[model samples]
Target: MARSKKYFNPFKPSAGAEPPRIIGRDQVVLDFVGALEGGVGAPARLMRVTGPRGSGKTVLLTDLGSRAQDIGWNVVNITAGINMLDDLIHELSPDSSVDSLSVAGNAAIASGEAVMKVKHPNLRALMKRCCGKSKGLVITIDEVQDAPIEAMQLIAGSVQHLIREKKDISLVFAGLPMGVMDLINGKALTFLRRAQSEELDFISLIEVRLSFRDGFAVSGLILRDEQLEMMARATAGYAYLIQLIGYYVWRFADLHRARSMEVSDEDVRLGIENAMTRFHEVVHEPAISRVTKGAMEYLVAMAQEGERASTADVAKRMGREPKATSSFRRSLIQREVIQSPVRGYVEFSVPFLREYVLENADELLDRY
Candidate 1:
């Protein structure tokens, strides 16, 4: 009913927070529309997106759900964890609740679902009813990596059954690249294996530049073309980094430059430094914590080298023979932590991961 007051930070850096304008993701939205309009059994109806942390998987799902809502579709978005199946059922249930349904952190379910009734139903039954009540039904799951296997199986199986019966439904989900593969490859999720899969990565630098221009103009914050280019390059085309840099830059201009709202070259520098500090905490630590000790050693060894880490050199650094390190290399590749650019060399797949490893290698190498 009312708009919030404007804040200096025009960028929304928090995960899943929709930015004023989504950039470089036109194809995803286009494909979603195509799939939605194409009806059941459309390859895009069952879409799975995979990406490393901070690569905008959640944001993409949020965008798609909003688009579906705009077009008379009943969109239900849920995160994968705990009682995710129950949560989905609750949303589709009458009154957005069933006396028997179990959910957590969903107080607004009743207000949002706009439903009325007292009976709880199974996923298939509830979804079919929801589909019947809407022009179309869209169920989007985020962080699919953490989805309980049995719940995921049930959801997938229900969607599969619904599809066979020709109910207008769509199932789109996103997760880290590694976990998505593991989930789909599980025993009961064979249907997921055939879904249209997408891997998100860096967006174009030009798009980031344009976004920066628009975000800056909103607050009358000015950066010359050269300075804007420098700031854009520092982001390396990562979506989170773009938000972080813009947020910090805005903050610095807001607090430090009270007299002038303009952004200077030095502001970009300090902003990036602070942004990286936040990035390390929010993105790097959790990501690296999940890597195995042996993989850390391999990554640390690779980080020790400036660029294009040679297998032989990495093995030497890890105090292992070249042949003995192949497993670690393959493991990292499969997990999308690293990539083999050339036959003999590897590199970090995520931007600045190598730098982070190098800066903290003494503590990271071989750490459990």
Candidate 2:
């Protein structure tokens, strides 16, 4: 028999990069495919795949799209967050009735409108007819939450019309938590309710309070249970943090030709330190406006303390009463620098933000 090759991975998730095949999300993929196959009731399904940043949303969507193609369904992917539908429509098929189904059906749909108009009519009609057939069509929207309200409304309207017409079409939207919230609040709610909303919950690592364990485990990067736990604790289950640690450990192991099966505590420590250096570079490199910087610093402080800070507390920390702090806080929240968990509790949601802040608290405070 041929010798078994050693496949060691450091960075657990290859989001932008394509994987040979999906591993862990088998059930999720099956559920999505089943919906596409009309395995339940309607072949048309809308699912919002959500998780924290770097939680493998893009990878999952890409894999699902590939799977959809393998089964003969035409797949149309639009990065709604980046471009509006008008831009997308113009890019896909120019010089055609925007709603003619045949304009979107040509084999070279990715190209000109002549073949598309003859084959597929409009985007909505083409997608509906394609989805109705044995070869279903799927549309996936990446970073869907950041999509403008107008785009969201337009997509929702299309989906609603399609469903009402009982056409065969399905959609998968992936984005940060905000994207899900936006859909629920907007006119999309009518469509969203009929669709399954799956929150890609983070891998729970209680000891490290993070999901690194699953990250390494799924990547086939074996580590001693204790060592893995330590690493998990340090990173607190953050997707990027886990990948950062894994990247370092794999690099160090490969460089030193050390044991591959079990990563050591020392290895974990070194990896974290290296990640911290990279984090520090990014955090300190940009000197934004004073107000933005001050608000960020204050939020960082709250994260380090592991407690939510009220507007009043935030004001006090920055040596400004509620008024100035309130204005700055609103901007920060809008920028996703801080989030309100409930009514009064404002907290930082980014992973390892506390540790980064504690390390540079003195310097950050000085700036303010």
Candidate 3:
């Protein structure tokens, strides 16, 4: 009997899962690392990462946190929620004694001959103790827009205090563009307006091709240049689709082969179809359901116009003045549903959204 061959799929399609290689984010990663090295008061120390769904904002945050840890900084990762502040406190100060530092009223507190009145312990002091020998503290919050305003305020206040004290600490927040904007616009988080904002865009085709080639080769499969190009084009620069396409294509190839081998065009086609189906079910449906009526109308008009549509064209199709459609256009852009590539042209930010809208337009328009 022949021995069975071992197979490993390197692509990860789950949310927040680190990819085998992070393509097209090298500059962002480098800037984050440089900020960590730059120490206290670096603008990049406070970062806000925004992108459309499946754009890998969480992955980028996770990778940056890992880089901080590797450089001797203490990292705490948490999702933005009602208990975000409490979670941060617990992560920074695990001991009960740290809680006692939050005494009421004006009480003189002495720490190594440095005396200060205690109103609350504050995150700064806790972080100071926690990062005794470490370079600093890095706190990453995902889905920041979902966090309660009170929690966001508390975090912002605490971070501001820490910054004023000149303690080494950094904060990174990842969320959708509008959500991030909402968080920043909060009354207490005015300081966040100054944060280094990084809006993640689509990955380049060249980079996607390189990722597929290198990723498959390491897994003991060879993808021909044309096959690689096909796969890359199918991904349409969306980070999640890249992994989804790769995962299915790799599996398709593996099932057809008894051992490691090359990926065929047939496998690529099936994989692309499967990936697109998943994309519609997972990304497109929910996004469409949440959009406003006006935004939906704009999207339908754009879908009818093909890949790239002008604002004037969309306005004409809607039978409304261009000025009348500006609000809807802005809303769509803020939602990351569409992007303006230039002054007058707008296109769906995600790949296949146009096709998705077109195929379902009859039903969608009926409901609308």
Among these predictions, the greatest TM-score belongs to: 1
**Candidate 2 C-alpha RMSD relative to the actual structure:** 6.8
Q: What does candidate 2's lDDT look like per residue over 1-368, in tens digits?
A: 97755556635434455444433466788887777777334533688887766566787888888888888777777786545565445534555334432212212212222222233255455456556665655778888777775555555556666666676666788877775676657643455545566666554566232244555565455567777666666555554455666677655544444345455667777887886566445432232234456576666556554656776676666677677667666766655556788876687655555566666667666775
Better of 1 and 2 by TM-score: 1
The Cα local distance difference test for each model comes to 0.82, 0.60, 0.82
State in Å the error of residue 49, model 3. 1.4
- Per residue, candidate 1 scores C-alpha lDDT tens digits across 1-368 of 88734555778899789888888788878998888988887788889998877888888899999988888899999999987866787788746555543322211211211122336556677889889988779999998989877677667777877888899999999998878988888765677888887888688999999899889888777878997898899999898999999888878776644477678777888999999999999988876677778888898889887678889999998899999999989988877778887899998877898899888888886466
Query: In model 1, which runs have C-alpha deviations exceeding 4 angstroms?
Result: 1-7, 94-119, 256-258, 290-293, 326-336, 339-345, 365-368
Q: What is the TM-score of each candidate against the true structure?
A: 0.85, 0.73, 0.84
Weakest ten-residue segment in model 3 by summed lDDT? 105-114
Question: What are the candidates' C-alpha RMSDs?
Answer: 6.7, 6.8, 5.2
Model 2: lDDT of residue 80: 66
